[model samples]
Target: MDEAALREMLDAVRSGAMTSDDAVAVLRRLPFADLGFARVDHHRALRLGMAETVYAPGKTPEQCAAIVAELLAQPGSSPVILSRADDEQAAAALAANPGGARTRATVVWRPAAERAERVVVVTAGTADQPVADECACTLAAHGFRPVRISDVGVAGLHRILDAVEELATADAVVVVAGMEGALASVVGGLTAAPVVAVPTSVGYGASLAGVTALLSMLASCASGITVVGIDNGFGAACAVVRLLPSAVTTRV
Candidate 1:
């Protein structure tokens, strides 16, 4: 339960609308809910300022639906986000609660009210769109509108140069690239915004399945560049969310 929900429950007890015993029952379930296959953390938002998200790689569609349904049932729970969800998993989640939206590899339900702060998601090339899309969707799920800057890798310096004004306005910047990951350094050097770099597995064999890019990002000449694992768009987005001010993040 969030602060608002906790206060409302206390008020109900004070006004005699809810018995003390009834309030205790609700509080008992606030910590977690056991679903046999999963123990859903209902108190996550209260502790972390954001709800727990589901990672759908190894889970069955039914399991995903069950977890999502339980989360939605909690009183005052924030939006539920599912990352790396395949088409089947996405369909099952939406079927469990028809009030949800999906992007390429992400699904969200009851997204929190959008915040005024913005995040910019920049992709190195077309091959990076999949990872970039996941980053954008995750940011949206967390209540931030992400401005997408596509195909702006260092190969065409002018492309990224053209986006300097747009990038400057973001609260944070997420740079997604493969193949040496030089884009992160370039974007980092150009904008004062905090940079969260994502290295994708989108290059030749010498790229070592994104290892080269990951290493390059780690050794970036540009200051203030943080790197996530290969193809980990979701992680990149969470990093950006943490960079936002408490006023924008604390609400959800």
Candidate 2:
């Protein structure tokens, strides 16, 4: 449960509108819910100002659906996210939990509140869009407004240069790139905002299937840039969330 629900419960008890025993019954599954296959983290939103997400890679389709259902059962505004689901897994999970807005590699279960903070997600090329889509989904699900600037790779210096206003105005930036991943360095140099870089497995042999890009981003000449694993858009989005101030309310 979120802080609002907890406070409301306590207020009900104080006014004699609800019994202490009934309140205890409602909170019995807090901290986590043991679902045998997985222990759903019901208290994460209360602690982190963000909720837990279900990673759907190794788990069974049924397990993923069940976990999603359990998370949806909580009383909070943060959306329930299921990431990296294949066709079968997405079908199954979306079937059991029918309302998530689906995107490439990710699905979001609730309509997040629109906040004022702006996060710019920039991709090196058209090929990097799938990774950028994943990052956008996570950012929107967590209530951060994601501004997408697409196919602005450094190969055409004029393209990324054209987006200077969009880049410079953001509260945080996520750069998804492949090949030498020079885009991250370019973006890092362009914006004063905190930048998080993602190396995608989108290049040929010499790119080392993203390792070359990963290393290039890690050793970027631009100082204070953060690099995440290859094609890990969800993690990149989470990093952006941590970098920005929390939009979720504390006393509401």
Q: Residue pairs in steric clash, candidate 1? A: none
lDDT of 1 by residue, 1-252 (tens): 665567788999999999999999988887889888889998887777777898899999999999988888877747789888999999998898788899987999888778888789999999999999998988888788889999988888999999999988888999999998999999999888899999999999999999999999999999879999999999998888777834623654
Q: Least accurate stretch of 10 residues (summed lDDT) in model 1?
A: 243-252
* 129 Cα displacement, candidate 2 (Å): 0.7
Best by lDDT: 2
lDDT at residue 243 of model 2 (Cα atoms):
78
Candidate 2 overall lDDT versus native: 0.89
| Residue range 68-103, candidate 2, lDDT tens digits | 999888766778999999888888899999888889
After superposition, which runs of candidate 2 have C-alpha atoms over 4 Å from their true positions? 247-252
